[model samples]
Target: MLATPSDFDVLIVGAGISGIGMAAHLEMMCPRRSYAIVERRDQIGGTWDLFRYPGIRSDSDMHTLGFVFEPWRHEKSIADGPSILEYLNRIADERGIRPHIRFGYKVVSADFRPDEARWHVTVELADGERKLLTANFIYLGAGYYDYDDPYDAGFDFSEFEGDVIHPQFWPKDYDYTGKKVVVVGSGATAVTIVPSMADKAAHVTMLQRTPTWMFSRPAKDAIANFLRKVLPEKVAYAITRFKNITMQDFSFKAARNKPEKVKQALHKRIEKALGKDYDKEAFTPPYNPWEQRLCLVPDNDLFEAMKSGRASVVTGNIAKFEKDGVRLTSGELLPADIIVTATGLKLAIAGKIKISVAGEPVDFSQRYYYKGCMFSNLPNLAVVFGYLNASWTLRADINSEFVCRVLNHMEATGTNLATPVLTAEAEAKIEDDDLFDFSSGYIQRGKHIMPKSAKDYPWRLNQEYVFDRKVLRQGDVDDGLLSFTRAGANAMMAEEQLEAAE
Candidate 1:
């Protein structure tokens, strides 16, 4: 892997969970390949660094959220935002992944030159200068949620007197102590904030358009703790990871197959916690479980808060923001000193980076993902979008390994460019599947701009991590559909051979 004019062999965008994991894998596997990561933010720990709202944490357990190569040594399975950030920071420090990260490098555009076998990327630097860098391949691990543009509920709060806030940019010094708080939206953020804010707030209300499915799990995983006490670190971690993944898969699959049974069981437990005052209709969603992600409440903190009368839940539409608080469509006035709009995230398709191949801009909506990593007909470009149903890191790990395998294959075959080539027949067989099968507000809002998927193997997203892990990890690298060609004189021989065969 001799160095060339193209700054490095590979350029990875974003230092988030996916990006960090990708960098780790590259360093471990393709040690000789010169790679650098460009992060728009000034710091690492992408999600854990960006979101700082009260009680902001992973809905997924730490066992799976933790990287496959690393074992989570923490006692709490349901970790807080700060703890997660610390974990990520520890990983970067221990693995020496920090030096390879170029913070404050916001990539605005990436143009691939097939003839030249290189990608010219333009990044907006902190000093307002546009820097053009080149790389042989580009891996977009920027993540899906757009922190810049959180989904605005379009509420006209000009008439209101309270402070409006969004969880994406929570102020560090802002105080809500003894203040009445009303959090809009029933997703994970709302549930988390309600319990956390209720500790000191005069009262907290979770206002929602519709109820989202919520499940309760213990904050501390007893089984994992016990196993670690007896078994070796690696051995205990492996067993715990497998158990959690299996349970997650089973829960999701069972929900899909028998949503009613799962719904009833969930409602029953919530009802028990909420007591007789629980409005079953208000808490019941029209959609089935897993249609949207199931919100998780560790140790029933939200329910405990509600039961203690410090917090409550209200399901209704907003008429307008009144002088004191939000006026429900039913004319119920929920007074609040502060309103946190935990509405949802705005999807950043391809990290909002302008990507082009041979001067033609890539319209991702028309392109289907190859094995949920590489885009169809896109050359030397791969995106590590993780599983919706499981830990995001799970898919990231698989995609990163697959990228390494592709790199190895290219080097073995002496190919400069690798592109997923689809025949007319293959394209015709493509099914119009959503890139992510989620019903969250943010996802539905950006549905039109999302990438497409197919019904065929590799092209069709299995959505399950187990299926992807098997295929992507064990499958052949020199697949027929993935076309590779040498840069200059060597490519002529490949064309000649193809022409002779026809």
Candidate 2:
């Protein structure tokens, strides 16, 4: 236990988008609070920095993905990886957040000391040395996937002579020029990679077990660009963000309420993009529009590549990998010089950091998610899990603001502890709900590790951003559910207070 002169008010994990957003919020709303950020990677921009595959870009528009406090001045709303990194860097430098970030430091585990009302965080440095730090609160801004490993689809590449690669660990400057490339998935990564690689590769094939629904939109937002020319940057950004958020919510609701109609509209757009002669089976997914995230194609680039015979789509399971190429279950042989396994990600909760309360390990699966941020019975800790239906930053912004509110309330009340306590009776009364309603492979596989959700507010991670914004932003801090107490308070006293409130 290394002792320091003072503990940080908040210790943020992962200097990514969520961490940066939370830090910026603290600066504005709780300026008196001290904080620090620990990043596992050597650089900023968590997702954007990690991925270096061709045509790597945001699935959602930048208006909503960009932080609420900062304006995305780039021309392209569907920004590339470098552009997004630049935006994040500008925010970090401009807000003086870079100085507070400690790169190459990975959080191994965190233990909450109830008596001290602080978390003892153990971190492993890049050189494999361990150090300890204490903080009043811990904010996990680390993004949801396993950074060390990608999803393994169990493809037998033993006999395949081609260079196999996963997008998570793309080799630097590895040329695929004039080589036949087969991207083994039809998710956003495959869609982005096929067209990008087709320019240099001899031919590119997007191989998928099942088709994925895709929608085509321009890379640049005409309305957003026009507004920027006439109005103030912040005002224009706000309007654009509002418009996009509304459209996203409406689209999701429409897909859920009227799946057939939404499906037809999506197919109609794809039909217009790809000619009538195109293979419809390869483009049509069995699921509804929003069941899984709809891949976005910028300016019909994918369609153009397919039309030009540079790229193609193959919808089938791989029977085995042959020396020359992949052999499909349909007995079709596709020749390839390189294979990219864009088979999606493996989700890890709380950045896979071992969390415990008073020496007893906390099982998040047994606990309830409180207001889409903190887990029930967890003291002074909040994890940022972004919304599935909208831009990741939408939830990030709201969660950051909400956490700040809790911190400020605790300060005003002279309390150092805030915990969402769910009693046995209350827990039994709440019916369990799925953490996420999406049928995406990652979501389905990661359900067991996720925090439990319930049927009502303040007890579940709500997916509706509009509803969450109002409740998390404007709702009272002392809502009878969250117990605020001073440091060194006995457990019995907190329980008695909760009982009295109930």
Candidate 3:
């Protein structure tokens, strides 16, 4: 059943931002060690390449999102998708990581062999051929969302004989110039699509089950623009990053502290923009602000679209699809030539790879996350996941740095194995109240895999840089779950006691 395998020191899954970042770090730190990046797609730039919705851009500014070593020279804070993809490609080229990338390679499964002390990975190539790769360690930089479209809930699309499209699979040759379009969902993608598509489409209608809190702000930072004119690109990037992060964090707190007052102010602004046409109650969301994400509109583009009569928001659940339109639950049918399903993404944890050790399944659902990097009982594996509040790359960069430190530590200690160990008592000390309570698919799926820590010590993500610096960056590399074994111990342990070996 086994075949000859290629070998490497490290094997990274996914060639997206995280994987590229990891590759950059690994190449810099461990040049002597061999590594390869396996990407399923023919090209890189994971989410950016996957999402083709009109006007799609970063929800957060590109400064902090960009790599620290490789400064992003984009003039706009919220850069477009093509620009971001280009930046990733540039980074990969600049760092010489492209040659090591195995494009059109998808890893099907991985198992940690206790006897061999290596991961036996089964990867399916673009051709119908399969191959194996043995590596000392595995890093899952695989993105969190599912690849297939999410709006496959068996909605009655046959009744509506008009064109229907999902953003994930947006057709390049689609002609929506003169057609009346109805876009469904209220996420960032929907917010972005409405404004851009409205500029061309005959009329655009935004259909939503619930309203998202929309905040309109300048797409380009005035100060950053001025800085770019005078200061160097790196200097401008740094200052703008600092300014954007401060403002975003402050806005997050502002919404949390004075929710009702802020909501009232936002409501007033919407009313002021729409005049008498603004239905006061129709645009309101039930939950506290940011409990679900707040949608950002660049330079009031969506608002301007609505004001210009190019776009209008319709708040109601879809009753069903009619012959030439969508019938809402509120006894109203909206005529449309095209319908765009902007439904939320389906989240797949660690890209849904089944990881097992010693022929026993590693119950990832039962495992707890440690520093959001490695899981309990999963050895020689590190995941680069970021914070929910800050830029994903910020946390990813830190995780990269931490991983380098860990590798360095392990190398210095002359050890080849390490994993987080959560004892029953340690796990029992965690409180459920301290965790993120959102019901989004991403959050809910993560809750099962993430660590539950008391607000103090090893279990908390305080959102403070200083605390993480001390806990994660400068923290002890050996806090117990990780055990080191030489060549002989692995074989002897497998022969004797496999369950307790780790």
Best by TM-score: 2
**1-502: candidate 2 lDDT, tens digit per residue:** 2355336999999988999999999999999999999999999999999999999999999999999989999999999999999998998898889998999999999998876788989999999999999999999999999999999988788899989999999999999999998999989999999999999999999998899989999999999999999999999999999999999999999999999898888778888988777787887888888999999999999999999999999888889999989999899999999999999999998999999988889888888899999988788999889988899999999999999999999999888889998887787689888778889999999999989999898899999999999998899989988989885555567756545433
After TM-score superposition, the amount by which residue 424's alpha carbon in candidate 2 deviates from its true location, in angstroms, is: 0.6
For each candidate in turn, the TM-score is 0.96, 0.97, 0.91
Model 1 quality (TM-score): 0.96
In model 1, residue pairs whose N, Cα or C atoms come closer than 3 Å (at least 3 residues apart or on different chains), thus clashing, are: none
Candidate 2, residue 392: how far the Cα is off, in Å: 0.4
Stretches off by above 4 angstroms in model 1 are 1-4, 490-502
TM-score computed on alpha carbons, candidate 2: 0.97
Judged by TM-score relative to the true structure, which candidate is superior, 1 or 3?
Answer: 1
Decreasing lDDT order of the candidates: 2, 1, 3
Please list the residue runs of candidate 3 whose C-alpha ends up more than 4 Å from where it truly belongs after superposition: 1-6, 149-151, 268-277, 433-435, 441-457, 460-466, 480-502
Task: Give the Å error, residue 380, model 3.
Answer: 0.8
Across 340-413, the per-residue lDDT of candidate 1 in tens digits comes to 99888888888999999778898988777789889777779999777879999999999999999999888888
What CA root-mean-square deviation does each model show from the true structure?
Answer: 2.4, 2.0, 3.2
Model 2 clashes, total count: 0
Clash number for model 1?
0
